[model samples]
Target: MFLHSRHLSRRVAIASATALLTGGAAAGAAWATTAAAAPAGPRTCTVSDLYVSMGRKEGAAGSLYWPIRFTNTGTTGCALRGYPGVSVLDAAQHRMGAAATRTGGAVSTVTLAPAHSASAVIRTTNGPVGGPCQATGTYLRVYPPASRTAVLVPAGWKVCSGTFRVAPVTR
Candidate 1:
């Protein structure tokens, strides 16, 4: 979903504050759990310029072949996490992340370079939602690292995001 620049700013404010409030002490918990279960990533660095590409329809409901592109654009590689987040803003649907409900979308393992990019597809459907999916704009905002704690959202420090559109798979 395309968020207006102003609205995006507000979303940032809400999301940041929420993260801060929830993550303050939780950050330590996450570290404790992750330290033993995982190894250090590509490196220790700040994440920035997170964004998603325009979404594609994937032929709608029952038969979906929709594609979404992703890129890191961060100073260092970051985990794409469990599933590529599929954010849907439907007055009728009323869902947060459509992919959360749908089972086909999968986030691939690829390291996004400063400008490098990749595309992935929802190969099959488990519980696909039908849509007259009228995408207003092609892009979704990126949620910055849950661990980025700061008194202020700094300059040149952009939260990640992507547009919503359909296209051939790119890498």
Candidate 2:
């Protein structure tokens, strides 16, 4: 009789442990599903949400390279994908040269938290490569991708090549 009681007690303990473990596992799975169902990431960056600027100037082999930067000024996180529209503008806001041609390259989405930035490479000839270059541009009009608004950055440089090439935006 004592042996029977001991065996029965052991079976009860095992059953209780199994039930607790199964309940805990089910609770954990429910929590995981709830967490995964949360909302998606923030929206794409607009021109108003970004503060545009020209980064450091670099020269190599008679070409000038500048990083066109877009900094997120808003409090929320945002994404920038693809190329930005670039054009040199005269003092009267007229287009000085043709719009910058897209420099073919791998483009990936860049996500920026508040105060973060992304950049694109801008290339131009170091000097007049062709003949009869005229009209100095006083500003660079930058249009962020998918945005209707544009930002003007002071250029204060002569565009001797009358052409600009811009690489895709990247982190």
Candidate 3:
């Protein structure tokens, strides 16, 4: 009876140790997965870190579309979310009209590494709806997402429509 009891105790001890080891391994695996899935926080792209430019222009149905590109010029990775503030500027650097309206789009965070770029689509009507264009614009003033400073991009053609719409920044 004594020998039998000892064998039973040994079996229970082995089982307990096995369970503990299995549970620890599972916990460790869960922690590893969570750590791997966690995203690294990136800084917001500042006006100095970004270079704004216009891409090829396209027109359809009396509306013009231009791709506004923001290139990350800094050495570190940065993020841009939502739409950029856009406005037409005359040669004297005065705002020609109200800021561009934000069009509906999926506003997701875009991480840009050094030298990488993201683009937003700007749509403007061919002409003013109510009256003739107030003034010819020589440049397009662009403000980075969540930034107050503006970047001036040369406009090859004058913008007739005072109102414009801008899509969200995308990869």
Candidate 4:
């Protein structure tokens, strides 16, 4: 017996559809596997992996700027994105005033290799700017982004509540 032309065309159509579906599924699986096997970027930098320090003081227009440096002391590379938490502390290890607010800047992920460094700028005034000096700071407490732990860098400044601002970390 011989098949009709209509029946033969329908069979071919079905076979073609099946082949396309199978090939598409296999291609999708292969793509997924390749993507999964790709290596990931560096992890976020933690306080334990960094050595924080205060850079030289700079002043302009009655505002004080300090470049807070974060050096990667770990064995591997890490990343630091966004702003670092900054606050003034008195001699007794107590918070002197309100925490430093985040200032405007181009925020991007800063990848630091081992022994490399990233920095952020903390701005305040020597005496007072927008408000009265709330307390005198003997040490500046710094918290790296996304980290709960904080490190203290020796600093002598008059701190005003809601007056301190910090820029984002950069290379």
Best by lDDT: 4
Task: State the lDDT of candidate 1 residue by residue for 21-75, as single tens digits.
Answer: 9866455544444344344355422334444553454454444454455556676
Cα error, residue 148 of model 3, in Å, equals 1.4
**Could you give me the TM-score of model 1 versus the true structure?**
0.36
TM-score of each predicted structure versus truth? 0.36, 0.73, 0.71, 0.78
Worst 10 residues of 1 by lDDT: 151-160
Error of 3 at 168 (Å): 0.9
- Rank by lDDT, descending? 4, 3, 2, 1
**Which ranges in model 2 have alpha carbons more than 4 Å from their true place?**
1-40
lDDT of each candidate versus the true structure:
0.40, 0.81, 0.82, 0.83
Angstrom error of the Cα, residue 47, model 4: value is: 1.4
Residue range 71-167, candidate 3, lDDT tens digits: 9999999999998998888888888878789996679999999999999988877777555665667899999899999999998544554657899
Q: Between 2 and 4, whose TM-score is larger?
A: 4
lDDT of 4 by residue, 34-94 (tens): 4554456899999999999988988888787889999999999999999999888889889
